[model samples]
Target chain A: MKNSFVELHARERALSLLDAKTAREIVGPLDNMISPHLEPQNIVPESDDGIVLMRGMINGNNVLVVSIEGKFQGGGIGEVSGAKIVAALEKVLEENKQGNTIYPIIVLDTGGVRLQEANYGLLSISEIQNVVIALKKYVPVIGLVPGRVGSFGGMSITASILSYLIATNKARIALNGPEVIEQEAGVREFDSSDKDLIWDTLGTKQRSKTGLVDEVVDDTVDSIKDAIVNEIKTKKDAHRTENVDFYLSLLNKLDLSKKLDIDSYNKLYQSVVATKHEVPAATAGNKEGTKSRGRLWFEKLTGIENATSSISTVLHAQKDGKEYIAIVPDSDNKFPRVREGEVGLQEGFAVASIVNKIVADDKDKTVKRPIVLVVDVPSQAYGYQEELIGIHVALGSSAAAYAKARQAGHPVIDFIPGDAVSGGFLAHGLQSNRMIALDDDSITIQAMSKASAARITQRTIAELEEATKHVPAMAYDVDNYEKLGALYKLVKGIGSWEATDENVVKIKQLINEAITSLDGDTTLHFRYQTPIAKASGRKATLAVRKLVDEEWSK
Target chain B: MEKLHFNFDTKDAISKPVHVGVVASGDLEVIFRPTDKETEVNIVTGSDGFKEVWGNVLQRFFDRYPIQADIEINDFGSTPGVVNLRLTQALEELKDEK
Candidate 1:
């Protein structure tokens, strides 16, 4: 109970780890950097937007401690909060790049993307992840889960991408929260009221035992700080998301008929011998595949109708030296949660295998193969099995692969024709340099489903829908998403289901144009630099980044 | 959400800005910025029709301290006691630094 790190607020938590008079808060509460999106929804905004960014020394090592306030909005990362993290981490990345070793430690206590800010939360989290990946090259990016609202949703996928994760027994980490799973997949799938079951599956102790979290420390401030200091001093790196082959091998060993409990999953996880997994391009088959927009577009673009692959859900092929990947639905797939084309275990690992292979193959080439992702994912598979086996890592693997591919000079593009929701979008769509979506009302694009988001945010579906009308970030349709200026281009004259020959040709030309526009630039800064992003979509984000840059130096 | 603003005439003037508290449930954040003009307290609270109660709380505090500053409070259904606590915390922050 003495100097408990988990008990302290976000600001106090940041200051506790730093030496006396050594801590300097960047974009602190005095800066008045509140979320502009909250007030319109009649929600009272916090001055720091529930994020405390501190730049100081941790045990004499230059460090940036980014703490999320669990008390405020369940530590949700919205526009200002996400921007503060991205900007601060990017600054740390810059400092580390200059041979000044500055480690970035994220005190994660978030519920991931704030459903209120919806698309912006997704965009900001992805931006934060992109910067984290870049910073890992210079210094080990450490993450700490100190209880209350443990990392979940898109941020857990980000957590899985960290160099090392240190957590107390008070914390839990998973891609989807228990309540969200219950809402999406029913109570039989996961009982939200069962606190024991929830904690047993997602607690840091189990996570540490299963390798989801690196270390489980005591609740004291000293213990948490010591773990962080030890990690920085030792430069310990977990490389959590790089094990595509191992996860693929693990997925191969999974038995689909029966329910997988926690103990059985742990045993299966340990018993697996990681073998090489090579997901080949989809080839023509006699039987028709599931007819989703992603599948339709993949078939039309690649001219491989009735596309069949070793992994049924994941289909990827090289057409004109440009690699195309899509995750489609399988009505009779072995994995039930992923039957509706959700980015589940196999889809994530298989996409990672394919993308990793593409990156490896193009390592020596002068020009890298441009990856076109046909994003039509509904949501991540929201069953207990997915969370029990750590689906965050699966999502993280693909996300990291795409980010690395882009960083390695491969132009990763998202051609969203269907749904682009939650963790599936993060793993597949959000990592790209450019995103082009069809101008169709049917294409649902947001952080979470309306039903689940309403439940989590404690608002009725009607209230949630009403809020969306005021805030574009809260909207579910792709048109509202485009308003955020996240898309590289909102392609018109084509329905989501309309992938005709001429439409395919048009899309292919747009894809080529988007790739050419990159001009060897690999950074996700393109999103911020876009006309829509600059105009209004990311106005607060731009302001937050500017303030962080100005204050980080001071 | 309701926005309430109150102005007070005060003698003592402070020249430091301090922020305290989190806008959590049943809690609020208070920010005090030094002002050359008349002292004022502005609040955006989640609970409506608390204008007179907030006035009483702030009026009581200012009667004792009479600090001249521009104070802003973002309250999320915090009781009068919590508001007084955060306001007093912000004053302590100011005095400690001074």
Candidate 2:
């Protein structure tokens, strides 16, 4: 018989890894509890909600294993399953606080967030992330991503944040699923039928080279067991204690534009490792006075000749003649990974701080100053250190801050002059009451890179391109995104990437129009009212949400 | 989804509660808890169309082993053979518990 652990079911995998005789399942099928949400959607509720939680012994140490059943609903997490996992982790944390030792091992095989119960799934994931960060302080939260479904969406971020991650060659990890990316970004960017491309982009081998995955093991029970034992035995908390400046200097030495293959990634890795011993030098004589693309846009929009740059990446400007903050990447930024305007740990916290401050300042004021976000973030910075420090919390905090600001009556407007990709866009722009993007090729917005999209969707770039022609969501161009009703306006005739005085004036007029259109209505529900959203399968989500609300009220 | 309840008259009772099988696709779980009243079996299945087949299977198993216990089964489209196997396994565990 083949010794591949990948072929084993979720229960079998968990049982095989732990001491077989001592393993006992918590909230096992016998509990008779299933998801209440799935039934209304005519979806079958598995006895355990497709998540197997067990208390067991691994190499004589007490451990808790949370395994996802990929065969069940693509191992998508719903309320019950999410709660079960969270409860188990919380219990472990509580036990540890009382001087009991119990390690957490998560076997991830999820596509992330059960779309059937979207809002609940989102809330559950946030809770899961909070507990994961809290639990990491005591024990190393080990993540094992074996193949079949692999891990994507919110779970991908969850796995990335683990203290130790082990994956087999068959495993793939990504922020967004291939089909979802294809559905949103178009076939031209990510063909959903190309298998080789998907593996090439998100496969364990490539991810391991990037240093995101701590260990790559063979697809055998013994190999996985050994790796887990070794990690629990020897691995200390590898949290980076050096300031953001240390990472910035290290990032500055290497190139970030290389294709994400093993060889190219390894070269960059070697370069970063090679410079670790060198003393951190001051960031000087490297175009210190020059403003980034984001700051330039901020200057143009606010008419502030020299807007005071605060928190390095975050720039403070005047909007509607009031204090407005614009977060941009510093080209000479100390945090190298987030230099090109990617919202890293520092940027996320900075954005949150600014928004929270604005909210505090405008607490008693009848009229709130509009917070204009000059959106040019490419993506969240992808690095081991960033994950170790819980970038999700930082990113989630920024999103929450924007939501809070809007609820506080601040007309949050997102001006997309450049790319707003993935979690970066989610943190900065998605929470805005009204969003305006430059109708230019440079203004691309999507969950991830086109190459990653193509790989996940198993489609050739050509197929993805062809699909984009028919599907507006698939196209990354701001024009295509505008059709989705997420954007209130798209400014045309921008002659250059650098906004001219005329272009700036036009954009400012549009922002005023957007703010006026809001008419003190600060909710983000207006996005769903767009023709595209109403037509493109959002009706089901709306209906389900309505049902959920009606039920909740009862 | 189908919900069915069955009762089998018996004198003997299960010594302890026992759980067997996983709720994976095409699989089912049988959880047996000791009850003083009667041997009651409650079943909830993924497929609503298999009500008669489930009744027949449970009837046969209860007839074969007249153990007085409250049995609850959550099935995810399991075949008759799989259901029979899980019930037998749970019964065997119950027997071993004595």
- Top-scoring candidate (lDDT): 1
Q: Which DockQ values do the candidates obtain, in the order shown?
A: 0.91, 0.26
Tens-digit lDDT string for candidate 2 (A201-235): 67787777655567899999999999999999986
- C-alpha lDDT of candidate 1 relative to the true structure: 0.91
Q: Which residue pairs show collisions in model 1?
A: none
Using Cα atoms with residue i matched to residue i, what is each candidate's TM-score against the true structure?
0.99, 0.60
Q: State the DockQ, from 0 to 1, for candidate 1.
A: 0.91
User: What lDDT is obtained when candidate 2 is compared to the true structure?
Assistant: 0.70
| Candidate 1 per-residue lDDT over residues A266-352, each given as its tens digit | 998888888988987899999988789999999999999899999999999999889999999999998888989999988888888
User: Which CAPRI level is candidate 1?
Assistant: high
